[model samples]
Target: MIIATGATGTLNGATVDHLLQRVPAARLGASVRDPARARHLADRGVRVRRGSYEDPVALRRSFADAEQVLLVSSSDIGADVVAQHRTAIDAAAAVGARRILYTSTCGAGFETPYPPLAIHAATEQHLAASGVAWTALRNGFYGDLGQLLGPWQETGTIAKPADGPFSWVDRRDAAEAAAAILAGDAAFDGPVDLVPSSPVTLADFAAAASELSGRHIERVVVDDEDWVAGEMANGTPEGAARFTLSMFQATRGGHFAHADPTLVQLLGREPRSIADQLADQNIG
Candidate 1:
């Protein structure tokens, strides 16, 4: 059977749905922190089991009888994310899983201002040393940028702490691609970057927003310190705000600018671009 962690999350949940279409539901299992939350998947013939990265025994049980395990990277800020990922990897390996696939990001590496990059890099190293075959799906940056970018429709300005030429990808595309990798028999020994051939900067986003909204949207660069302070004032946790800051710093350094056509090759078509997203969303 194939097992997937973080079944309740958007990306992983979408991946599970795609997997169900590609393979038999009996061959799929979802390891979630709370089995109760995954009742829908359980009803669909998936073996929903309680599993947490913090608990190794539960993870082992959840991963039992699995030939491959899709391990979602931990998102616990201020926690030992690397160790948590290692624990999950070790548990999957112990459960006799022949192969492990991790949802890593394209920013993974040592030389980056982004803090999560180090965590992802360390996790990749641990997975490589676990004796089992591993694949790191280096996904592009994916998230809702409207909040950080402010209400351009109302203010006609997109203000952000950092301006990035990020290769933002749709989570649905990435999820489907991941399911394809898990269900197919193609061997990918190491890291594979799931990014598009093109990238869009914040300026490009402003232009698209302007066109879609039929208004002149200006790109405004806010002060770094002031941006963090404002985010905190708006009730965002200090650590979360700082993490966003580091992301901008990393982006300013061109860490997220690197684009590749691996995603297009995986899906046999061009991945949806940020412009398409703007046109479809209500924010634009």
Candidate 2:
């Protein structure tokens, strides 16, 4: 049997949806924080269990009788995400899981300026020391560039801090690749980067938007402090604004510039490009 954490969320939910097509519902389990939200899955005959990284006993029980578990990383930005992951990893090991696949970031390392990158790195280290087989799904940066672009359709301008390139990837493609890995016969040990076929800078993204919408979208580079202040003025919390600003700092440091083909090889085709994603989303 296979169990997936965060099964009600977008990425893992998509993975579970794909898994249902390849595996029987009896062989599948969903570990969600709120089982009430996952009633649709249960209605389809999936086993739903309440699990939380904060509760080790519940997590252990959720993983019972499972051969493999997909540990989707938490979205809590202010919490001690490393400790939460450690609790889940220990619980999976205690349940005698054959393998644990963790969703990690592409530039998760000690030197990255992004705070979550360090948390992911620490979790990977803990997983290595655990007495269970592990695979780190190094997913690329999400392709929700519109959030940073700030109403580009009406403003006709994309403003951000001066940054470097990033290999943006759609969550849909990442979900499909993760489903393939989880349901495949072969084993993938250690870190597997799921990135796009190529990387694109912010200017390149603006150009793509301009071409897709047939509108002149100007790319404006602003100071980091000015960007943060602007975000706060727009009603974003101060902490959240600062955290979002760090991503550009990390990108300027060349953390997310590299492209990897692991996702392409897993999917048997090239991953979607930034231009295609923008065009599909109809972002001006």
Candidate 2, residues 132-237, lDDT tens digits: the string is: 9999999998846668566778888888888898878889899999999999998999998899878778898889889988989999998999988998899999
Winner by TM-score: 2
TM-score of candidate 2 on Cα atoms, chains taken together: 0.96
**What's the TM-score of every candidate structure?**
0.95, 0.96
Q: Please give, for residues 171-274, the per-residue lDDT of candidate 1 as tens digits.
A: 98899889989999898889988987877777888888888877899988899999889889999999888888988898888888888877898888998877
Alpha-carbon RMSD of each model? 1.6, 1.4
Candidates in order have lDDT scores of 0.89, 0.90
The window of 10 residues in a row where model 1 has the poorest summed lDDT is 275-284
At residue 27, candidate 2 shows an lDDT of 91
